[model samples]
Structures are given as structure tokens and as C-alpha cells.
Target: MCSRDLKTPWIDLNTLMRGQRRVLLRHGERPYQLSITRRGRLILTAADQDTDTAAAAAPPGKARS
Candidate 1:
């Protein structure tokens, strides 16, 4: 829901997340992690490089938080 005179590109979660709770995005050598919270909120953070950098949508792990 945007109201502006200028134009902007937007991507839906269904298309972006692709039915998963988490997805890894890469820009240059940096890795970004996008996650869906338990409250149905969105969070984007720098991902750990030591882990997998496959840039795939992964099934959410057990997070009671």
C-alpha cells in the first residue's frame, strides 16, 4: 500500500519468500538473511558467513522466541 507520485518496484512475500519463513540474499560478498517472525513480522539482518550461503529459502527452525 503505497501512495506517492514517484514509482517504485515492490516484491510480494509470496514471490520473494516463496512459501518459506526464511531466505538468504546475496549482494556482492555480503549475505543477508530475511526472516518471518512468529508475530508475522519481517526481519532482515546480516547472515553468518560461517554457515551455509546457498541463498535458498529454508524451512523455519524451532524458535519459541
Candidate 2:
């Protein structure tokens, strides 16, 4: 016989961020950056800080398809 009743700890999203810009930083030979805007939009910036990687990676010409 086996039991499946288990309790997990709760994690708060705000607590994780702690009121700061949350950016995903890739570290390696070819590093990159990604983040969620205050308006709740996904953003990607290159090292040059002029190109939007997310926009470029987006499906041809669709918001999210």
C-alpha cells in the first residue's frame, strides 16, 4: 500500500522578486537577457541594448502564435 497525501511549502511570487526588476540573465559565451515589463509584456535585449531578441524570435508577425 502507498499514501499520496503530501503537503508542499507555499512560495509567494512577490516575495521571490522582492520589488526589483526581474531579469533572466544567460551566462556563457553568448549571453543574453530577458525580463517581464511592468506592463506585463515579455522583453528581450541584446548586449548592444538596441535589438529586441524576443521581437525577433517571435513568430513571423504574430503577437503569440
lDDT for each candidate structure: 0.72, 0.48
Error of 2 at 26 (Å): 2.2
lDDT at 13, model 1? 87
Best by lDDT: 1
TM-score of each model, paired residue for residue: 0.69, 0.32
Candidate 1: regions farther than 4 A off: 1-6, 53-65
Residue 60 in model 1: lDDT = 53
Clashes of 1: 0
Question: For all the candidates, what are their Cα RMSDs to the real structure?
Answer: 4.2, 9.8
Residue 11 miss distance in model 2 (angstroms): 15
- Model 2, position 47: C-alpha lDDT score: 42
Return the lDDT, model 1, position 65: 21
